[model samples]
Target chain A: MSATNLNWRAIAAIYRFEMARFFRTAGQSLATPVITTSLYFVVFGAAIGGRMGEIDGVGYGAFIVPGLIMLSVLTESLNNAAFGIYFPRWTGTSYELLSAPVSPFEIVSGYVGAAATKSVILGLVILATASLFVPIQILHPLWMIGFLALTALSFCLFGFITGIWAQSWEQLQVIPMLVITPLTFLGGAFYSIDMLPGVWKTVALFNPIVYLVSGFRWAFYGNADVAVGISLAATLGFLVACLGVVWWIFRTGYRLKP
Target chain B: MRPILELDGLTKTYASGLQALKPTTLAIREGEIFALLGPNGAGKTTLIGLICGLLRPSGGVVRVAGLDIVEDYRRARSLIGLVPQELATEMFETPFAAMNFSRGLFGRPPDHALVERLLRELSLWDKRKDRIQTLSGGMKRRVMIAKALAHEPRLLFLDEPTAGVDVELRRDMWALVRRLRDTGVTVILTTHYIEEAEEMADRIGVIDKGRLILVEDKATLMRKLGSKQLTVQLQERLEAVPEALARWRLTLKDDGHALEYRFDTQAEENGIPALLRQLHELGIGLKDLATEQSSLEDIFVSLTRKAA
Candidate 1:
C-alpha cells in the first residue's frame, strides 16, 4: 500500500506503546543480556580463549563476538516481540487493537518494528561490551549492519507469531527456552562448525542458526562456514515464512476472534 | 434520518457448534441511547462484538455510518468507540498515557486539550497520572471511558458499563451517557438492569437464547406491555375469591385479606370500577384499595420467560 493510504498514526501509537513498556522496565530488560554477555566473555573469552589457538586467523576472544551478538539478538528479538503482543492478549487489551481502525499489516509492523529495534540495540550493547574485553574489527561494516537488522527483524516476526499462537505463559516460554536457545548454542555460537568432524558438521548444517551465525561471523572476519548468499537467503526465507503465518492468523482470526 | 449503526442478519456460530448469536438484525438511530437488555448468556456481548468488528460474523453485514464494516473497516471502525465490560487496559501506564495512546490508535492526531477535557469530564483528571492498576475500580472504569471517547467517535458501545459498580457510580455513568447522547453521539449499551434501561434508554431490546425477542421504543414498550395491579383490601378474611367476582380473575392474597386484579395498562376498559361495584353488591365491604404499575423488570422477566 502507498504511504498516504497506510495508518501511520496507529502504527506509531503501537510502536510507541511497546517501546514505552520497554523503557518502563529498562533495568530488567537491559540487565539480563548485559550480564549474560559478560558471563560468556568471562567463561568463553577469558578462560577458554587463553588456552585455545586462533581459528581462521582471528583470536578466540574476537572470534566469538558476532556469535555472542547473534545469540543475544535471536533470543531478545523473540522475547521482546512475543511478550509485546502476548501481554495485551493475556490482559484482554488486545480487544482494543482487534477493534481499532488499524489493519493487520500495520499492527504487525508496529509490534515487530519495536521488537527488532530493541533487539538491534541489545546486539550493539553486547558488541560494545565484547570490545571492552578484546579488540574487534568489522571487515565488512555494511554487511554486518544488514545481517544484524535482517536477523533481528526475522526473529521478531517469529516471536510475534509465537505471541499470537501461545495461550498461556508456559507456552510463551517453551519455544524460546527449549528450542531457539538450544539451536543458537548448537549453531556454533561459541565454536566454529568447521572444528566439528565430518558427520557432525553435516548434521549442524540443518540448524538454521548456523547460517545466521556463519553469515554474521563472515561480516566480522571475512570468512564463513556457510556461503553468505545462502545465509542471506535463509534469513529472508524465514522472514517471509513468518509474514505468511501472521497473515494467516489475522485472516482466520485464530485465537483472536471467536 | 439514516441510522448511525446497522446490523443485517448478523450471525455467529463458534467452532464448538454453539450458536452464540443467531441471525439478528438491528438499526440504531443517531443521537439515541439504545439499551440491549438481557439476562447473562443472552448474546448481548456477542451482538456488540459483531457490530464492533471484534468477532467475525458467520454470515451478515454491519455498517457504521453507511460504511461496510468488512469492506471499509478502517473508516467504519474509526467511527466507533467501545468500552468493553471488562476493565481491560494497560495497567502499568497512567490514565493520561493510556488516553493519549488510544486516541492515536484510532487514527486521530494528538490533542492534549481534548484528552484533558475527557479526563476532567470523567472525573479522572486528578488520577490521570496514577497507574491504572493502582486506581479504584470505578476510576479504572472511568479511564476506560475516557480512552474510548478520546477520539470522539460518532457511535459508542458500552457493554455492561455499570455491571459491578456502586449506585453512586452507576448514577454518574447514567448522567454521562445522557451528556454523550446530548452531544449527538449514538450510544448502545447492554445492561441486565431493567431500571437502567428504564432510566436511560430511548429504546430497549430484549435478547434471549441468541435471538432478539423484542425491540421497541421505551415508552411504547411500557405502554403496550406494562400491567397495573389493583388490590382490594377486605374488611374480613376470605377463604377464597368470591365466585360472583369470577369475571375479574382475581387472585386471593395476603392470607385472603386482599384480592388482586391485573389488567393491561393500555386497555381502554380496565373494568376496575365494575369489579369494585360487584364487590359491594356481594356485601363484601372494602376496607381500602390500591393500584400499582408493573415495572420494566416485570416486563423483562415475562418476556424472557415466554421466549424460553
Candidate 2:
C-alpha cells in the first residue's frame, strides 16, 4: 500500500453502499426524477408546445427535451450527492468512514462516482421518457453522452462539496432549491434565451446553466446559443472549482473531523 | 520485544482552545489487555480518536504495529480496528454485508469465511441476514464489534465498549475481548468502569484531565496502593487500645470491640503474627478475625479525585 496508491476496494465498497441505499428506495429514488421530468415534458413540451409554434426550426416540444433533461440532471445530481454525504454525517456514520484505511481521495471518488452514476441513469431515463411524447433526434450521439456525463459528473462534484459544507439538512437544500433550480429554470430549460429581449438575453448569458443547457441542447439539435467550446470550458472550470473545494474540505477536515 | 503500539508526545488541543489531551507517551505490548481507565471528559476517547485517525492530533505521533499512524497511515490504519463509542452508519445494511464492506475498506479481499466466523463469534450469525435496524440495541452493538473484527486488525481499540450494555452482554463482551487477546491481538479499551478494568485488564492506565496519571500492572497497582486491612474482634470490649499494642497502629472501632490493622500487601512484613504475639503478651484475647482488601473502584475514585 504505497502512500499515493489507489484503493479500488474501498471506493467500490463505498460506492456499493451508497448504491444499495438507492436500491432500497429504488422506486422513490428513480421515480422522482423520471416522473418530474416526464411531467415537465407533458406540461411544457406537449400542453404548452401545442399552444406555441416551433422555435429555431425545431418543434417547441422537441426543443425543450434537452433543456428538460438538463433540468432534471442538474437538480438530481446535486440532490443525490448532497444527501448521500449528508446522511452519513448526520447519522455519525462518517466516523467509520474517516477512521477506515481509506484515503480522502478514495472516499470522495466513491461518493462522487455513485452520485454521478445515479444522476446519469436518471438523465437517460428522462430522455427516454421524453422521446415518447416528442420526436427526438440527437445529431451527435457521442457528444450527447459525453456532455451528459460531464454535466452530471461536474454537478455531482458540486453536490459533494455542498454536502460537506452544509451543517444542517436545511442548508443542503438552500443551494439546490434556491440557487440551482431557479438558475436552471431561468437558463432556458423551459424556453430558449433567444425569446428574451436584448437586456434579458445578455443577462441570461451570465447564468452558468445556460452554457450547460446550450451545450447539451446543441448535442441534440446541432445548434447552441453559446459556443460549444465555451460551454465545455465553463463546465470544466466549474468542475475544477468543485474539485478544489473538495480537496480543501478533506485536507482541513472541515466539518468531517472534530 | 518491540511494542505493538507506541504514542510519542501525542497531544490534542482542539480548535476551541481546549487541550483535550496533553503530551502523552505510552507503549502497548502485543497480546496484552491494556485498560485505559478514566472518568468522563478525561481524554480517554480523545486518545483513542487520535490513534484511530478520527481526530487529528494537535501534536505528536502514533505508531501501530510498527507503522507511523500519520506517515504510514495506510498500513498503520489497516492494522488497527476501532469499536467506536457510537454505532456506525449502515443501519440498513446486514451485519454480514457491513462487515464485508468494512473489511474491504481496509483493502482486504473478500473472505466470506472470515465474515461468517466473525458474525458467529459475535453471536450475530443467526441475525446475519437481518438489517441492523431490525436488531435490538444490544444486538446492534454486537454488529459493531463484528464489523470491527472483520479486518482482523492486530491492534483493536474499544472505546467504552460496554457503556450501556446489560450485565450479561458486558460479561460476554469481556470474554470475547479476552479471546481476541489470546489470539495475539493487542486490545486497548477505555472504560470509566473500575470493575471492568479490574476484572479484564492485565495492565491498567489511569488518565485524567488530559494527563496519564498512572499506568501499572493490575496486581502491582493494587499492591502499590497497599489496601489490605485486617479487623480483629476481642472477646471483651476494651476502654481503649492498650499502649503495649501501639506499635501496630491499630484503630479501635465498634466501641473498642474491633481493632483494625492496616498493612501493605507488597511489604516484606505484614506484622500480623508479631501483632498477635504482642496482643497475647498484653493479655488481649480475640473472639474472631476478619480481613478485607480495597477494590479497584476505590483506587480509581481516589486517584481521579486526588488528581482533580
lDDT of 1 at A23: 87
Cand. 1 Cα-lDDT: 0.93
| Candidate 2, A1-54: lDDT as tens digits | 464488889999989988888888989988987788778767877677789988
TM-score of 2: 0.96
How do the residues A121-218 of candidate 1 rate in per-residue lDDT, one tens digit apiece?
Answer: 89998899889999999999999999999999999999999999999999999999999999999999888999999999999999999999999999
Candidate 2 CAPRI grade? medium
* Local error of candidate 1 at residue B258 (angstroms): 1.4
Q: Which lDDT value does model 2 have at A112?
A: 90
Where does candidate 1 clash, by residue pair? none
lDDT of 1 by residue, B1-308 (tens): 88998889999998999999999888999999999999999999999998888898999889899999999999999999999999898999999999989988899999999998999999999988888999999888889999999999999999999988999999999999999999999999999888999999999999998999999999999999999999989999999988898989999999999999999888889998899789889999899999998999999999999998
What is the alpha-carbon interface RMSD for each candidate?
0.7, 1.2
Ten contiguous residues minimizing lDDT sum, candidate 1 chain A = A21-30
After superposing candidate 1, which stretches have Cα over 4 Å from the reference? none
